[model samples]
Target: IGIFMWVSSTEASWQDFRKPCIAVVDAKTPTTRIIRAVSVVLLPFLVGFLGYNSMKPSTDEPIELRTVHPAPPASTKVHGKTFVLQTASNPYRVDDSGKYSDKVQNDYKDGNPWDEKAPQFLQYVREGGQIFFQNCHFCHGDNLNGRGMFAFAFNPIPANFTDAGTIAQLQETFVFWRVSKGGIGLPREGFPWASVMPPWEQHLTIDEIWKVILFEYWHTGYYPRTWD
Candidate 1:
C-alpha cells in the first residue's frame, strides 16, 4: 500500500557513504583511536542521561493550599442585610405549627408537593426544588449528591450533600451564608477563588435561598446541625 518511486540504482552511492564510516574506524594514529573509543563510551552514557532526565516526573501543576469548608465569618452581608451565621435560620423550614422544631418537619416528609392542600414545608421544598433544577442542579446534581453533569468541571468540584462531612455536619445558617454569598464570599482560607459556586443573593431572593436549603435537607433526610 505504500506507493514509493524507487530507482533501480539501490547500490548507486551506498559504497561511497561507507568510505566516510571506514575512515573513522580506520584510526591510524593513537589520538584518532582514543577519540573513537571515547566517543563510543560516551555516546551510550549521554543517551542514557538524556532519556532518564526526559522520563523523570515533572512538577508543573501548582499545588492547591485551599481550605474547602473554612470557618465561616460570624456574620455576612447578603442583599444588603447582614446575617449572623450562628443565629440565622431557614425561615421556610417549618411545620403546620409554622416553626421549625424537633421532628416537626418529619411529619410532612411524605407530603405531596403538588397538592393544593400540601403542608407549607412541602410547598417550600417544592419551590426550592424548582429553583435548584433551574439553576443549581447543573453542578450540585439532580440527587444533590454533587454528581451533576457539570460537577467535575470546577477545580474543587461541588459539595456532595449525601456525605456526613458536608451538610450534615454544618448548621443550616452556615449553608444559608454559603448559598447567599457563594464561593466568592468565602474567607481567605478559600484562596485563589477556584470555586465556581455563584453567590445566589445576586440571582435569588433570601427566601428562595432558605427554601433551597430546606429542600436540600429534606431530600437528603439529614438534619442540619445547629450551633446550639
Candidate 2:
C-alpha cells in the first residue's frame, strides 16, 4: 500500500515538473523559431497544393475507368411474362464432341464480324484495351506477357500472348473460343495444371471479346494467318 502511494506521488511530481518545463521551453525562443512559425502558417497551403496535384489523374495509367463503357447489366427477363435467368450445368460438358477436332475446317463462331476495313476498328480496339485492363490484366499482365500479379499463384502460368505459340500462330477464332470458354473449356490435355481462367462469355459480349483479341494482336504486332 505504501509502495503504491509512493509511485502515485512520484508520478504526480513528474507530471508537475513536465508542466513547468513545457512552459519554460515555450517562453524561450530557439534559433529556428521564425522558420518554424512560418512553416506552421504555410503547412496547410502546402498540403492543399500537393493533395490537388496528387489527385489529378495520370496520363500514363494503362486504362481510364471513367471513359470505359461498363458491361451490360445482367437481366433474367426473356419474354413479356415472369423473368428468370437460364441456369444450366457447365455448357461445355454437354458438347464434349470433338469441338476442335478439325480446327481449320470447322466454322468457328467469329465474335467480331467487322474487319480491319471497318471505320470503328480503332475505336473497338481502344474499348477492348480498357476491357483487357479491367478483366485480364490481373492474370495476363499489363503487357499481356502472362507474368501478371497473380501469375505466380497458378501451377502453369497464364499463356503469354506475345509468344509465337500463342496469338501469333493460332487463328482469332481459337483465341476467341478459348477466352470465352476459359478454364472450364480446357480439354483433357489442358487438365491437371489447374487453370484459373474464368469464362468471360458471361461478362463480355462476343464483340467485346473480339475487340480485346484485336488489341492483343495490334499491341503485340502479330498478324493473323490469311485463309489463302
Full-model lDDT for every candidate: 0.81, 0.58
RMSD of each candidate?
12.3, 16.0
lDDT of residue 43 for candidate 1: 80
List model 2 lDDT by residue over 47-143, tens digit each: 9889999998887735322211112112221122222112211111111242322221122223342354522444455677788998999988999
As a whole number from 0 to 100, the lDDT of residue 65 in candidate 1 is: 64
In candidate 2, the residue pairs with backbone N, CA or C atoms under 3 Å apart (3 or more residues apart, or in different chains) clash, namely none
Residue-pair clash count for candidate 2: 0
How accurate locally is residue 104 in candidate 2, as Cα lDDT from 0 to 100? 18
Tens digits of per-residue lDDT for model 1, 1-228: 222223223565556656555766887778768777767788888999999999999978677865656778889888888888887777887767787674756776777777888877789888988888999999999999999999887767798898888898988888898888888787774577567788899999988898888889888888888777
The TM-scores of all predictions, comma-separated, are: 0.73, 0.46
* Model 2 spans > 4 angstroms off: 1-119, 188-190
State in Å the error of residue 21, model 1.
22
